[model samples]
Target: MTDKPSGKSFDKLTRRQTLAAMLAAGMVGTGMRSASAADFAAFNPGYAKNIVMPAFAQLAAASESLATAASAGCADPKAPDLITLQQAYHIAADAWADAQMFRLGPLADGQRAERFAYWPERRNIIDKQLSALLADDDTISLDAAKLGGSSVAVQGIPALERLLYRDEPLPPTGCAVIQAIAGNLVAIATEAQKAWQQAAAKPAPFAANPTEATTQFYTNLLTLLQIVADQKIGAPLGGDVAAAKPKSAEQWRSGRSLRNIRRNLAAAQNALFGKGGFAALLTPEQSALADNLKKAFADAIAAAEKAGDDLPADVSDESRRHLATELLVKVNHLRDLLRQDVPPVIGITLGFNELDGDGS
Candidate 1:
């Protein structure tokens, strides 16, 4: 029998469920303009149903698959079957990259997003936590609930990569930890999906202010592109080709940095223009900017695909550095267009910085 995560985490949509429940009790969102219900009429609710919720749901499903694979492969971390386990982790990580941009609402609460995949390795926290957790057998358990409450460092994709991709032999307890982490991830993803679905069902939880909602949506899109440029590529690329730091890139252990970039771009496109997406609401001039944004993203994806899986090396290679540089430029241009052109037409002024909202 396949091991399963406890159902409790999925049921724990504390923040979002509370918001929706409050709405059901006829509590108006604070500052909701009572007369402006029709202002957001043109906005498509499908962005939640078709894009955000589905993305988290997919992450939950992928996390389940990873947990199952880990359970079966835990007994023999070096067994040939671990390949299947590794592939499962890749699928789950890609799902995460796609959904990472929706960092508002449920995603922003409880350190949920960071718990799934903390990046930039600011202090090599994942490795440190993994070491500590593996050595502390008394604390490790196969149960998802207990594991989910553990350190974020040892409970997500980064820790998984250390175990699955490292050349060193797995610890005696490594397999159990892997399974536990996978289960924890499953619960986190499932809860995120449920929270989004609950919020989407009630207009008050999401659309209380159409202008604010639209601005936040576009802000997320811009932020995702900026992250792609700044963190995914620029961090490893450093200031110049000579200073390239391959180890600094995301998923560098698994060599899927470019692959993650491709997934990020596709997710952004879908979120911005998918069914009931923001594209339908764009004006003629705004539509032109949107088209350019699409082209830039497509070009970026093509360049990344050409770069293949070993993105750090691709960025470091003198002849190939140009491609990485080109991708960064394109993404930056897309961000500029979104920053300068689109918001005014949509009646929202863009000022928040993607990293810190204090206008950079």
Candidate 2:
């Protein structure tokens, strides 16, 4: 459930708003007088070239494959075609999980992210909307442009997941819906990739300015970590063992909830520690912090992998649930290091108000 909305006031904040808060808090600029523009000269371009662009490109390519598979599945409605469609879906979903961490630029434009994969749907909006769309006599839902303008719940991967991952064979209408969604996904991914390519070619203000870009990327990193620990893991875990709600987990119907978490963590780790990543910005004095951040991320990813492909049966199932708990702990620790420790070393000053609360 990437970027799921919650009732909490803080959780309601948009990604842009959250980034604004980080900036207002001085969580992204150089506070050290010794720090200079030259120190971070390569940061933004490196990320754009090596990380963001490639992820979006992969997303675009995977989505094209998914669209093709959906069309073939619609024609045949056969077991093998269905299996191939599912495989393509897995590839596209993995690409999304990798790309979603960099929730800036074109990905944030025009509700594109929500339209790609709406989840953590507490009210079962996807099911209800999809059912309504399927039952409609009109052909409006089959048109990609019109469908993109419809309820986002029925416009993305979740809706397609409901259609494809079911026990019964998809009816013709359902197959049409699948094709519509796959087409929409392709359009979104392609537009995003193109937009990113253009933005990378002519850097935006945030991308051109080292301080602003650093702030943007760091804010994205912290927010993703928080989301994984809170909404992704904590929601399903619930307050106690008996209260556990495994279905609350993201993409549970496809049995990839834990896999999504692992992929998200892996992507974030790469953005932060991969070649030309933030880890390179650290000086010799910050080596210990860099090493600790790397280890924390490694431990968190390991715990997520250990949790298996899906969430545990219940929070009381210590053998598996404990791994989820361990993951939450490790992720929180990693976020804390980045939030509380890294800023000072990297020359960013955390504002008093921002430090007063978790900032969600």
Name the best candidate (by TM-score).
2
Q: Write the per-residue lDDT of candidate 1 for residues 1-360, one digit (tens) a residue.
A: 221122333234333444433333322244332323343444625566677778888888899888788777765644536688789999999999989998767776676876788675556767877888788876445567776776666768888889889887777777777888888888889888888877764443353454455556666778788888888988888878879988889998898888898899889878767886767656675656777868866777777777777878777888878777877777787667767765555555554533632121
Point out where model 1 deviates above 4 Å.
1-44, 75-80, 139-142, 204-208, 284-287, 357-360
Off by over 4 Å in 2: 1-12, 15-33, 77-80, 201-208, 312-319, 349-360
lDDT per residue for candidate 2 within 85-171, as digits (tens), equals 889899999999998877666766666877898765747768877887888867434777778888778888888788778887665
What is the alpha-carbon lDDT of model 2 when measured against the actual structure? 0.74
lDDT of 1 at 301: 73
lDDT of each: 0.71, 0.74
